[model samples]
Target: MSDFIGDWYALLVLLLAGFLPNEVWRMLGLWLGGGVDEESELLVWVRAVATAILAGVIAQILVLPPGALASIPPSLRYGAVAVGLMVFIVAKRSILAGVICGELVMLIGKWWLG
Candidate 1:
């Protein structure tokens, strides 16, 4: 603890500056959404908007990723996404399955390509 001041400070900053703020909003959302009907039009619209935003972000990442992700070929990235989607559907919309499969695909593709 005494020797790793920088690492501890970074962790503290991450918890205070990032995790706490996100957690507050998440808790607020949970409270606010507690009474909202799942079938309500507003909820549906919000879900759609959130999905669209996520899709857009994913598209942007695939198209023009920053850092090391950009070094991977576009084909590999797109192929991973496709495989992930397939796994997602085949696995009964399991997000964990989709993400794990997608990451595995990306890693294998990168290794194979290299």
Candidate 2:
């Protein structure tokens, strides 16, 4: 849109704000990972930190969702996740099967409950 094109400085700032953290982390990972062994303490710490951050984000989403998922009950949300995991494990980690099974479960739940 013309408005967006006219606001090029704002767009540039937004782009940099979004990209810089990921770029910094990627570059740092490349720098540190080049010489480091997989079992190194720093690598382990980084992995643990990343896992914790991801878990926190997932927890927040589950506990306090926004958008369409917010309309679904927490129990159903967790149930879908559990069912998806079971399907994934049973199907030897087939991503498609897991996704389809989870979506099917949600659809069924919505139809039956709503």
Candidate 3:
């Protein structure tokens, strides 16, 4: 009984410690940004910057992959990204489709090459 209570107590503490703080900021952002126009110049610039940052991160991962990803070969990595992008466009910009397709291509390429 004590062990059960201790386990739940630890879980509650962990949840509060990790989740509540992030949620507070997210809720605050939602409230503050409620009046912002999506088509405004500021939002457009923010979107572009976010996209650029995401592209940079992806490029870094492909060019200088870490751990097991490094063993997959650059050609496969590039091919995955290309195929993923194509699928993303073809699937009406579905992020899930693109990500899954890219991951599948990478895994299949690695398996076949080895």
Candidate 4:
């Protein structure tokens, strides 16, 4: 088991195969995206849709999470979101600050309650 796990050649092959498709598209996008207007209406709509999708996924996770997240109380998850959003708003809508504070509150709640 250890020999198979430690095989560098196999690891390299797996990593390359996993990244090849996405990385190729990313490289192509970098090459071709130069002419795209950042402020275009289509781009703005795309961003909005992407953000909405992300929010939907986060809501699903908090409301009906699986495995380890399921073990944590739902109320705690809701609290984490509330506090995180509050932090985000209080910190002038800094996404990083909100995410970090929300995660910290969840972790602390888990630790303190147990």
Candidate 5:
């Protein structure tokens, strides 16, 4: 414990390194955007870009899933997306419900098709 504590510089470096990566951006945002308007054009553009990034990530995972997901049938994947979309529409675009239904479809598919 004494030896470990003696490495204070290393611990400080580790703490700074870990905190600086993502937290710095968040801190900078708070500093620079003290009075950000939700309906502002720039904010709207940011939201659009964020949504695009989220959609792109989802699409990438669905299209080229790794490991176990890769073994799942393509038909299963398509059907899951269809069911999710339907649920999303019917549920008035509840993303949570849509994702749950999609995941449920995939889970059922794996079990039934096994």
Candidate 6:
């Protein structure tokens, strides 16, 4: 605990690094939101960009994860996602059901494969 406290600066640096990009986007949204209409081209562009960034992040996590997930096959990762989406759709788009099903599928796949 003392060692962890002594490394507070490192933690602060990491937290800032992780936060700055999202903070910039949040600030941008606030700045633009008051004047922009939902159907406007600028808003559409922003939405597209945000969606692309989110998709890229998810893709990277599933395809090139670090730690334990890195050991799992890509097919299993994607299969879990597909099953999760199916569960989400079948469960009236409940995010909790989707996430739980996806994680459970992944865990089962990992165990079976291992």
**lDDT of candidates 1 onward, in order:** 0.91, 0.87, 0.90, 0.91, 0.89, 0.89
> Compared to the true structure, candidate 2 yields what TM-score?
0.78
Every model: Cα RMSD to truth: 4.3, 2.9, 5.6, 4.3, 5.9, 2.8
Clashes of each: 0, 0, 0, 0, 0, 0
Candidate 2: worst-modelled 10 consecutive residues by lDDT: 29-38
For model 5, how big is the CA root-mean-square deviation? 5.9
> What's the lDDT for residue 35 in model 5?
76
lDDT per residue as tens, model 1, 19-83 = 99889978987888767677989879988998999999989989999999989999999999999
Candidate 6 backbone clash number: 0
Better of 2 and 4 by TM-score: 2
Q: Which stretches of candidate 1 lie over 4 Å from their true place?
A: 1-43
TM-score sort, best first: 2, 6, 5, 4, 3, 1
Off by over 4 Å in 2: 2-17, 29-33
Whose TM-score is greatest here? 2
What are the clashing pairs of model 1?
none
Residue 85 accuracy (lDDT) in model 2: 84
Q: What TM-score against the true fold does each predicted structure earn?
A: 0.60, 0.78, 0.60, 0.62, 0.66, 0.75
Candidate 4: where is the Cα deviation over 4 Å? 2-21, 94-114
Tens digits of per-residue lDDT for model 6, 1-114: 887577777878877987886798789879877776779898799789989999999999988898988888899889999999999999999999999999999999899987
Misplaced by over 4 Å in model 5 are 1-21, 92-97
Error of 2 at 25 (Å): 2.5
Query: In model 6, what are the clashing residue pairs, if there are any?
Result: none
